[model samples]
Target: MVFYLTNLLALLAVFVILGLSFNLLMGYAGLFSIAHGAFFGLGAYTCGMLMRDAGWGFLLAVVAAFALSGVVGLILGLGSWRVTDIYLVILTLAFQVAVVGLFANLDITGGSGGLVGIPSPSVFGVELASPFRIVGLAWVLCAVVAVIVYYVVRSPYGRVLKTIREDEIAARSLGKRTASAKTGAFVLSSALAGVAGALFAVHLQFISPAEFGLGRSIEVLSLTIIGGLAAYWGPFIGAAVVVIIPQALTFLELPNSLVGALNGMAFSLLVLILLRFRPQGLLGRRSEAPVGDGGGRFAPAEGPEPAPSSAVEVRPASTATVSRDGGAPHSVTAAGAPPIEQPPPGDGATGPQGRKVRTLRCENISIAFDGLQAVSDVTLQLRPQQITGLVGPNGAGKTTLFNVLSGLLSPDEGRVLFGDDDVTNIAFDKRARRGVVRSFQDMRLFEGMSVRDNLLAALTPTAHEWIVPIGLGGGLRRPRAARADRRESADQLIDYLGLHDHGDTLARNLAYAEQKLLMIGRLLATGADCYLLDEPMSGLDQSGRDRVLRLLRDTVEAGATICLVEHSLDVVREACSSVAFLSDGCLIAEGPTEEITGDRELAAMYFGT
Candidate 1:
């Protein structure tokens, strides 16, 4: 019975490591990797092979396992660099299968048999032969790893990872190397899994290919989701329940395989239910409910408005020059559509390289869905440092056009040139890295992370400065001079945006307008070359809109370009340098705000001229 209890405790310890590792990616980073099991397997197999074949000691095996798994994860991260969401999952799935298959037939992997007799580890000469010692070892390892996990999530590098998870494009434009950030997460996650695998092998006195299978990966994912993503304790709770419950059943006369199957079914249902009702998982703070307690799957609803959608149902954005109501010739007034607020052009444009940069050129861009044209023959440009508005009736392709420019969608025809770079083929991440950034129409910032950190993370990839560097140095790089310069810059930007006091506050802690500003701050902090304001003045009252307008001006003065997509013509009239009218994905007219509104064709389309 003591042996059995020890076994259960050891498993629980291992699961704790798994939970924390998985949560770093999902809960904090907001990346959902279905190949967690593959990472786990990589650690186990690599360590097992190194020890059994190389005659290495326990510590050596652990090192080998982590290093090998991390290397593989880095490679995989690069491979999946361009893959987003659904495609990313598919790519990971393919990689998972490939990794598992390689182990299945390889001589080093012991084929289907797996490596056995992976010799139980020892500290000095005292072998980890007794169950009590194993349990103690597992707990000690868990504690050490737990400390590291705590530090990582709270560190600057961890903050950047979460930002990337929230919105990769935004992170990129903020001067963050998103690919590298993602690779960092992958490497860290894999290393933890490898370390856990090393411990598992030592605890069990064996290793098997069958042990680290896809189901195991799913189990890891389940623990993260059910345990409550976005919070530090969520993983601990999840790991304890998952590993302890299953282990207890083994001693209760149930077969080990049966325990595995039960776990599988239970976690499957767990994920499904979480998705249906509580997408945020247990400890995760909800992003939608702008004003609520920081945790769960929920959104505040003042009315019957539909839930806003973005990547992860929490975040992601775009461009353009049009409003929905076709502007009538000679009737284009300020604040043209409802909900869009017009601000005075108080500040100048934040141009390129301290130079007044202007000019946005979209050449013959087109978009279609299932052969039906959603936006076709779309050609539009917004002058530099000036607000260019896109307006037309609903479904006129204004939003679609925004997606194309922001690299969210690849146009079926033509190309997009932002001051000369052919952005036509650039991935969303790449485009963002090159100075293009967007705010979600839905406003999806990291809900659980501190509000101040949200802004900081936006600047993180670009700031490249730090208060102090970590010993591991696997995450954020912090040199004194760079760090000081960035902090000063960030502090000034935050103060200018009137969020200096709220820097330490979590995103969900803010009000609706505050959240919007937080997002805007993120863009500014990240150093967006091009600011695509998608309904920026949406959901704002007069004061909030005024504040945003003021910020826009500040951006222009800071040398940033601005493009406004809105339904309000009055707002455009007061703010835009030029306007492009879109009707059913086709550009009906383009010129100075008044000239385009005066076009006879556009006037008729908006309201029978």
Candidate 2:
């Protein structure tokens, strides 16, 4: 009985590792890859082959298994980069089936006859053949894995992964290569799964294709989901329950056919019950759930509106000139009035590298969705160091054009020139790195993270700056100096944006206007040269609008370019230096704000002159 208990403990440890590995992708990264079992099989096969056929040592074989599985995971991740949700599920499911078939068919994998004689590992020449010793070894490995996972999730790169999981579009705007992040998650998770496979093979002293199949993958996934997706203790708790409960059933001495069926039925029922009552899992915090606490899906929290007395009104110019160079000094009018705020003294004046990033030229850019043209032959030369408003009626292709410029959508026609370079085909993350950043209409902040973390993540170094350690350590091993610098930057930005009091607050908990401010703070953290803001001033009251307008002017004075898409024409007339009017996928007019706003025909098209 003692020996049986030891073996059971060892098996439980192996499942813990597998559960953690699968959770890294499904829980943390929100990637639902069903090919984890295939990775496990690959590892078992690789380790078994190396040890038995090549006369390799146990440790060497395990390492080889990890590498081989990681390679396959990378390939699969790259292939499924564009697919998501149910489609991604199907894709990975197909890959898993293909791998199992290969294992069953291939002579090298021992065909239908399972590979046997997988040798047990030893530490410092001490044999671990006994069940107790095997259990000890497994627990030690599990402890190490736990430490590694803890540190990785707390690291900067892990923050990026969380952001991607929450909102990939926001992550890309902040210069995170989400596709690469997902691929890295797969590699790490699969490599760890490989480690589990190696342990399993050694413990059982045998391996078969049937042992690592769809059934095993489903079991692992259920373990994670039932425990909690975002909690650290979730996998361990889940694995314990999953491994122990089934083993306990053996005491019942049920019929062989009924045992397997009973186990499967129990798991299915547990999953259904948990999903119905606790969708976020047992250990998950209420805030960690995607939906709100009261069982409603994202019904926003309310807060006090900005007081009327705090508003800073801008003055409209009667005779604003159209100029590429610095504009003439204009005056501010009454507080909280419909007045255009003048470009404080030298708004368009160059600073440091003058005119270097002054213009973003979109030439004949066009895109169609299912034969319906979204943005047709739209062209604009946008100048820097000033706020340029993109104004048009609903469905005028304003946001569509913004998407094209920001690299969210590739145009079928024309080129996007940032100065002399043709950056039309660059990916969204790449475009962001090159100082072209955008904000979404929905304001996609990482709702799961704290407001401070959202700002800090934006300042996290690009992947190139991260130096991998000699071991398989991830971003946590990055240089301390760099991490400290980023943290300092985050603190400074938070204070600058007046979000110091709410620094520790979860982003979703913030009021609507505060959330908008947080997003703008995130944009500032990206250090982008051009800011494409979509409906930034939406949901803001008079004072909030004034604060944002002031922020925009300050940013322009500091030499950053701004292109804003707004529904409020009064705001366009008051805050923008110039305006581009679009009508039905076409640029109807582009010039000084005063010129476009005063045009009778354009006014008729927009507000029925």
Candidate 3:
């Protein structure tokens, strides 16, 4: 009984590591990969061969396994850049099959019979010959892995992973290289799984392709989902249950065949029950609530009714100017409150220094889908420090032009120039990093995160977003000064947007107007020089629209360029200095706002006369 218990514990430790590593991809990064077991087998085989054939030390072999597995994982991660969801799953499944086939057929891996006689591991020159000794060593490694994972999930790097999982496009719009982040996570996960594989081989003194196949991958995934995803202690709890169930069933008087079937059925039933009643799992909490369901702490509220069309007056671009570095006070007021005092710019804030006045010009751009023109030969320029409005009736291709400018879609003809540099072929994230950021019509905020976190995630200093630096610069804690600066900046923006009271509130729980404010806050956090807003005030009351317009005015006064798509003529006239009108995928008119709005022919087309 003592030996049996020791062996069980050792197995549990090995699987716990696997669960922890796999969660990095499946839970935080939102990657559904079945190739985890293949990585595990690769590690096991690498370690086993190094020890058996090369007579390498256990520690050295484990290191080799980790490196080799990580290299392969890097390849897989790169491939994942082009696929997602079901397609990504299929890609990983194929990788799993290829790996297992190699392991089963390769002579170096002992073919179908499996490798054997892997030497025992030693600690401090003491061979872990007995089950008790091996189990102790296994637990020690498990503890170390647990500590690493704890820090990893709490670091800024971990936040990026969660952001990717929530909304990859939104993350990209904030200048996050999501592909790089995902790849880093995949490599880290694969390396750790390799370590677990090493432990498994050392503990058993043998390994087979059967031990690291699709069944094993599914088992690890099941344990993770059954316990919880993105929960720290979840994998531990799950591994314990998974390891104990089959062992516990072995004591039954039933036949061996019956026991195997019973174990599979029991896990399946448990998973089904969890999916039916507790979809978030035993330890995971629901990340989002249905809008207007009153499930969040700060539910949507009906504020003051829409103000009169003339309530908001157009202000000259030069008035109410504030320092972009937050060094000067702004005259814009929020909710009739006193003018907001600017805090001294922190490291996260962008100032006007080293900035060049550039114009974004789209020259004769055209695009078609299924041979139907969405945007055709439209030439438009957005000058610096001016608010340019793009207005047209529905189906006029206003959004398609926005997509082409933002690099979400490419135009079949024409080029986009920023100043003198052509940026038509740049990736969306790269374009965003170059100071061209956009908002979405649907307000794609990270609903799972708090209002403050949503803003904080937009402040970028790429160094804080990698696994190595995060692990090296004091695990479990972010750099104090940088973190404080980012928080201060985020808090200031939150206050400016009248969301100070809801900083800790989940974004999904905020009312429609508040959510709209949060989206603007996030956009501002990017510190972009050029802004492309899509229907930013669509769902807002007049008061909400006023607040947003005030912020935009302040931003423009600070030397930023703005282009917005607004359907309300009142808003366009109040906020825009210039306008570009489109009709049926063609540019109808472009001029100063008063000139365009005063044109009877254009007005007739705009109002559908």
lDDT of each: 0.68, 0.76, 0.80
Candidate 1 lDDT, 1-609, residue by residue in tens:
777778878988988888888888777667778787778878777666676677777777888888888788778778767777888788888887888888788987788987887776777667777788888888998898788788787666676777677666555545556676677777788788888888887887676677877778778888888888867888887887677666656667877778777767777887789888988777776654344345222322122222222101111111111111111101011121222223322224433334435355788888799887988777776566556788887888889899898888898899998665688888766676666777778777776667657655655543332212331333344455644544555555555555546666667667676677777777766555577878877766655665666666656644456887888766777567678888878887787888886677777786645
Off by over 4 Å in 2: 288-356, 366-378, 464-477
Candidate that scores best on TM-score: 3
Reference-based TM-score of each model: 0.73, 0.87, 0.89
What ranking emerges by TM-score with the best candidate at the front? 3, 2, 1
Model 3: pairs clashing at backbone N, Cα or C within 3 Å: none
* Error of model 1, residue 126, in angstroms: 7.2
Worst 10 contiguous positions by lDDT, candidate 3: 317-326
Q: CA shift at 139, candidate 1, in angstroms?
A: 4.5
Q: Is candidate 1 or candidate 3 better by lDDT?
A: 3
lDDT of 3 at 432: 81
lDDT of 1: 0.68
Clashing pairs in 2: 314-339, 315-339, 315-340, 315-341, 316-339, 316-340, 340-574, 604-609
Candidate 3 C-alpha lDDT tens digits along 284-339 = 87755544555343344344443443222332221221222222223332232221
